[model samples]
Target chain A: MIQVIAFYLFATLTIAAGALTILARNPVHSVLWLIVAFFNAAGLMVLAGAEFIAMLLVIVYVGAVAVLFLFVVMMLDIDFAELRAGFVKNFPLGLLLAIVLVCELVLGIGAERAGGIQLGTPDGTAATAAGASNIEAIGALLYSKYLFLFEAAGIILLVAMIGAIVLTHRQRGGVRGQNISRQVARRPEDATVNMQPEVGKGVQL
Target chain B: MTEFFQTIGMTYEWAWFVATICGILLIALPLMLAVAMIIYVDRKIWAAMALRRGPNVVGPFGLLQSFADGLKVFLQETIIPSAANKGLFLIAPIITFTVALLAWAVIPFNSGAILADINVGLLYVLAISSLGVYGTVIAGWASNSKYPFFSAMRASAQMISYEVSIGFILICVVLWAGSFNMGEIVEAQKSHVWIINGFVANPLLFPMWVMFLISGMAETQRAPFDLTEAESELVAGYQTEYSSMSFALYWLGEYANVLLMCALNATLFFGGYLPPLDIPVLYLVPGWLWLFAKIFFFFFVFSWVKATVPRYRYDQLMRLGWKVFLPVSLGFVVVVSGYLMYTGHFA
Candidate 1:
């Protein structure tokens, strides 16, 4: 009964926050609402007994992704009037996309209600133990059955990161950046000269 | 707590509700008092290290200084700038304080004595501590000022930068312990060897302990890494615009965070709530006392570092975090994992 109450509360808030994420005028507020939605969805995942995944969701989305969103959004100097000017112009396309998305979701759910495609056949070799925690189950599967796929996914991410860096990175020829190690390694004698000269005579270079 | 409540004549749900409330008070009230005492201790340490007499006015040896400051701050008006986002400005400090306290829920005070004995306790701590940056970031934006905004930028960037190395360092510990549970991490350190009490493993070469300590200092925005609030430059960083209890909340929250880092250092690298040595005779003293002693020792180290080390330049700080700490910690992660697997530690 308590779980039911908690589930409903999470569900209500998730829906409310999702709605507000779109309806909010301020971009910052919208991002915050989206974060709230993510948090509530994580709570819902927790209610569904996917505690590890729920934490990952909160950790990845709310902690990193939404923070980036907030960082970018706060720095933006968006003119609401100018932004609104494009709303009507893009309304038809947006509406069409929304409708198509809704249709896809509906059809997906309907197909699942009908003879749904089973993602995989039950393999006794990789079966999760009854009492194992979600993390344990995930680790078991991820480290064994899906290990290659996981490695491939990791490689793909690595490639993408490298590609992004390669694509954007540029060298400005004359810009001086601090070489901290060089500074630390410098000895006083190397950087300066202590010389004695006759009185009233300047030290030779 | 629920059982205790039931013995006092209450239904199960009511008992549970009462127990939770009581638990919150038990942690929070004491934490507040600790923060007050810790402030005095920090000042004294900082002063002593600087070869100066610290607070010697209020209560014996200025022990009540924090309380006096708190009362004064409490009496002052919560002045909101007309240009500032009032709601967010007010909510920011509350978020900071609450998030600061929330991470303590998973911290094992003694064996099985945590408020929440969740399996992913360390991950929860990471996630909550990450959320702490938001308070400062939001405060900076909400304040509608440039200095505060710049401070906020520096703070968030510095925080996120250090968190990467901190994450990898924690992964090394987690890999060493073979568990995410804080209690298990402590127990894993109970090997008969005194040197192996920490997850450091191979003390001379394995530098994860020092890395974790440095990262913890950076994560807490302490001196040397305290570029965010460098007074000469940013004029108190994200805190410049804040006043009254709002400002006081930030102060409390920042110290609370500093204390939390100290606790983490104790829990992760030192024997948390466990005695320094594994001698059975030493177990006579309570676990919580040991935890407190370790916490105080680490706090003194924090203050000592603050006194000794000069603040790093902003770019130098970034270079240390990204260029230096990240690679070293990441390399150590791979090394530790490889060594563990080779030794069949998992087996």
Candidate 2:
């Protein structure tokens, strides 16, 4: 009963935060709302006992991604008045998209129900009784059954990394980039000069 | 309803709730006080190492100096920058301070003195500690100043880099112990004779411990890795514009994080609260005392390092973290995992 209440509380906060992220006029306020949404989502993940995922949400999404968003928004020259002008123009299209998205979600739920899916029901009570914790069960499945899928996901991420590099590979002159090989190969004498001033004003030493 | 109430009354669940609440409060209050004292101790240690007298006039051995300074900060007016993001600027310190305190909930001071002895205790600690970067990042961004913003960016990058190495090293420890529960890790250590005693036992484990220590120091933003707060460069770094109690919260939170890191190091490597000897008479000394001793020892070591070593340059720090620590820790994890798998110890 307590778990149910806690789950509802987190879900409500997440939805509220998501709405506020869009509704807030100020960009910084929107980022703050987005952070709140991430936190509540992490809370929901915790309630589901996916501690790893919950941690990743808080540590990576809230800690890194949202902070990056805040940095970008703070640094950019964003005029709220100008941004608001487009909202009136885009309102009809936005409403249409929202309705279509909601309809698709409802249809997804209906299809699952039609397939005789029993959400949150155990396949077999004896499976849980077989001396494996949730983490262990998930680990077993991930490594044994879905190992190829996991490796494929990693490969896709690697491809995305290369693509990002290729897209943004620019040569800006003023930025001093590291040349490790040259640095390692150069001798100290080549980079530094031992200077002795000739004694023009005094005596030569 | 009467029967239900009676059954609820008869059960000890309320006692558990009350006990948990009291435990949490106790952890919070003392931890804050301890953090304050740690600042005084750190200053005194630094002064002593430099052959100078520290704050001695405020209280006995300058004990109340932190409190006096804290009061001064409390009375000072908070200055919010005119161009800053008002809401985020206010919320940043609170987020940092609260997250720092929240991590203490799962830390086992003694055998069973933790507020909540959750099964995923170590993972929870890692998760919560990693969230501290948000506070630093937000403070920098909200200030709308160049110094704080740059410092925050440096801090975010540095912290995320070291955290990966730290996590990999901790995975080696967890693989050896075969459990994420901290209590079980300590218990596992108790069953084995000290590995350092024999040459035949795993010699590689010590390097993993060293990796954890280094990564932990970096994570806490202590000296050598304290590029975030390098005074000469960034002018107090992310907290430059903060004043009054706002600044004090950052100060308190930083020290609290250092203490947390120290406690975690003790728990992971130093056999936690367990004393060195197994003598029966020594068993009477409660486990919490041993834990306190170990934690203070590490805290002293941190201060010593801060006073002794010069800060690392940004490039040097980054190189050490990624090129040196990451690969070393990753290799250590693979070796340890392979050993455990072959030995069937976890099975």
Candidate 3:
């Protein structure tokens, strides 16, 4: 009964917040609503017994991604009218994308309801061993069964990151930056001098 | 606790719900009280370092100073700026205070004494702590002011920079402990090296502990790294435009975060609830006392640093977090994991 209530609560809030993410006037509010949607989606994952995935969802999406979203959105000097001006121009493309997404969702759910397509027969070897926690089970599978695929995914992410950096990074001339190592390595004697001079005599450089 | 509630003739679900509420109260009420007293202690530490008395009039040795200040703030009218995003402005402080308290649920005060003994306890802490940035970010934006906005920008950037290194540092601990469960992490440290009751005793882990301590300080926005509230630069930072109870909540929330960081330091490195030595005779004392002692010790270290160290330049802070701490911690993660694998520790 509690699970039922929790499921409904999370489901409702997820939908509502997701809708608000698009509907909100302020970009900052939109980002915050998106975060709320992410949180509720994490809750749904938890209810599905994917606690590890749920935590990663919260940590990665809500924590890091949404924060960056909010950071960018908050800084934007938004013109609401200008934003709305593009909406009509973009409507056909948006509608096309939404229809495609809805079609994919319907097909996916229909496939699941029609019984999952079997690529291979399930072997007990891949099943989560009894008494193992979700994390352990996932770890076992990830490290043993899907190690190459996992590493490939990591490599893909790394390549994407480097690509982004390369695309955005530029060198500007005449910009003097701090040489922290040089500063640290400098001795007092190297930067200073002690001298005794007679009256009206200046210390030599 | 659920069983205790069940004795009163409630159904299992109701009993569980009531027990959870009771548990929350148990942790939160004392946490509130602790935050208040910690403020006084922080002042005294700062005062002693500066050769002055701190908050001596409100109560004996200024024991009631925080309470008196709380009362004053409570009595003051909440002043909302006409230009501020009013709803968000008010919600910001509550978010700070609540998120500060939320992570405590996963912290094991003693053996089997955790409120939420979830498998991914440490991850839960990470997730909740990450949420803390939103309070400052929202407050800064909602204030609709210059300084606060700058402070908020600094805060968001600073927090994100430090969190990267902090995450890597925590990974080293998690690798060494072989568990993401907070309770298990603490348990794994028992007699970790010979008679030592902490991972800190290990030569490799000691450096990680030091890095964790410093990163923890930065993560909590404690002094030396408190660029968000560097008054000489940004007034009170995100709280510059806040007034009344809202301001007080920031105060309470900041100290609470400090305490939480101190507790994390204790738990992660100093063998939370475990005596420094693993002698059987030492186990006679209650675990919670040992935890409290470790927490107080770490808190003193925090306060001492706050008193003695000067604040960092913003660029320098970023440099340390990224150019220094991040690479070192990431390297340590590899080194620690390799050592664990080589030693067959997981086996």
Candidate 4:
């Protein structure tokens, strides 16, 4: 009963924060609300016994991506007035999308309920014998049964990384990148020249 | 009504409540005390190495220095920068300290003494420790300062890079142990002659142990791998804008993480809480004592290194992690896995 209550509380907080993230007028406030939403989502994941996913959500999303979002938002000169103008213009479409999303989520939940879908729970003997904790089970499946899928996912990520690099590759004349070969080969004579000049003779070599 | 009350009394689950409370307290109290002692020991060790008397005035050899410092921090006002993200800035330290403490839940002090003896104990530790980067990142992002932001970016990149090699090394350990259970891993080691005793068939275990120790040192951001808090370069790094108790939390979190890494290193390789002995009679010395001895030895090594080695350059650190450690660990994993498979030693 307490677990149910805690789950409901976290679920409510997640929904509220997620809603506020989109609905807030201020971008900074929206980002803050998004972070809260992410945290509550992580809490929900934990309650569902998906600890690895929960941790990944917090560690990867909150730690890196959300932080990057926060940094960019904080540093950029964002004109709220200009940003808000689009919201006013697209309110109908936005509302339509929101309604559709809500309906889809409700439908999904209803479908699951109707199907009597249950998450697997291991018996104590099996758990002990197999050492099949949530993480262990997931790891076993990921490495063995779904190894190809896992590798494919990794490959896709690698492709995305390469794509991102290619997209962002810029050759600017003003900026200099380190040239290791040149640095290694350069001699002291090339770097410096000792010139001796006679005292009180400015023009003398 | 009297029968009802008796029935209720009979059904009461006081043990469950008591156990939960004890578990929480077990994690909390030692963590708090350890943090305090870590601070004192760090200063004393550094001071001694630098040829100075370290904190001599507080108590006997300044044993009470950490307590005094804690009190002072608690008394001091927390300064909030005007342009800072107030919520994240305020919550970052708590996140850091809590995450650091939570990783201890799976760490076994001795056989069957862990708060949670989950089968994925090693994975849980890895996951929890990885989450610690969030606190640093949040602190940097929220501070609205350039230095903190740069420090956070550098720290996140460094941590993520090192974590890959660290994970690889952990995989090697796990492969050898053939179980993720930390206790089982230690027990497995106990069944064999000490790797250092020259009677062992495994020559590769020592190299893996060294790799794990080095990776762990990097993961904890200790010298000479402490680019995250390179004072001359980053000016206190992610906690640059923090003050008083907030600053104290970051400090505590860092040391706690270092200790956790040391404990993990002991558990994974150096026979955890198992003493180095082949004599069956010497097993009477309680595993907890052995664990403590091993942990402190690693802690001493950490301090010794910090005192002796110069910090690596940022690029050099990155080069070592990505170019050297990552490839080596990856190759080691492949070789170990193949050997284990061929020998029919691992299932």
Q: Write the per-residue lDDT of candidate 1 for residues B5-42, one digit (tens) a residue.
A: 99999988889878878877888889889998999999
The complex in candidate 2 yields a DockQ of 0.46
Q: Which stretches of candidate 3 lie over 4 Å from their true place?
A: A117-128
The residue pairs that clash in candidate 2, if any, are none
lDDT of 4 at B319: 83
**Which lDDT tens digits does candidate 4 get at residues A21-80?**
989866766877898898889888777767667767876676557756865675678787
lDDT (CA) per prediction = 0.85, 0.82, 0.91, 0.79
Q: Provide the global lDDT of candidate 3 against the true structure.
A: 0.91
lDDT tens per residue, model 4, B253-343: 8888999988887787777776667466656889888887888888988898899999988887788789888999899899988998998
Clashing pairs in 1: none
Query: Candidate 4 chain B: worst 10 consecutive residues by lDDT?
Result: B193-202
Clashing pairs in 3: none
Q: For candidate 2, write residues B1-347 as lDDT tens digits.
A: 22343465633545555556677788889989999899999999999999999999998989999999999999999999999988889888998889889888877767765676666777788778778888898899889899999999898889888988988988887887777787877766663555321111336577877777778888889997899999999999999999999899999999999999888877887777777555566569898888888789989999999999999999988998999999989998899888878989777
The DockQ of predicted model 4 stands at: 0.26
Best by TM-score: 3
* iRMSD values, candidates in order: 1.4, 2.5, 0.7, 3.5
How would you encode candidate 3's per-residue C-alpha lDDT over B93-144 as one tens digit per residue?
A: 9999999999999889999999999999989999999999999999999999
DockQ (CA atoms), all models: 0.57, 0.46, 0.79, 0.26
As a whole number from 0 to 100, the lDDT of residue A176 in candidate 2 is 79
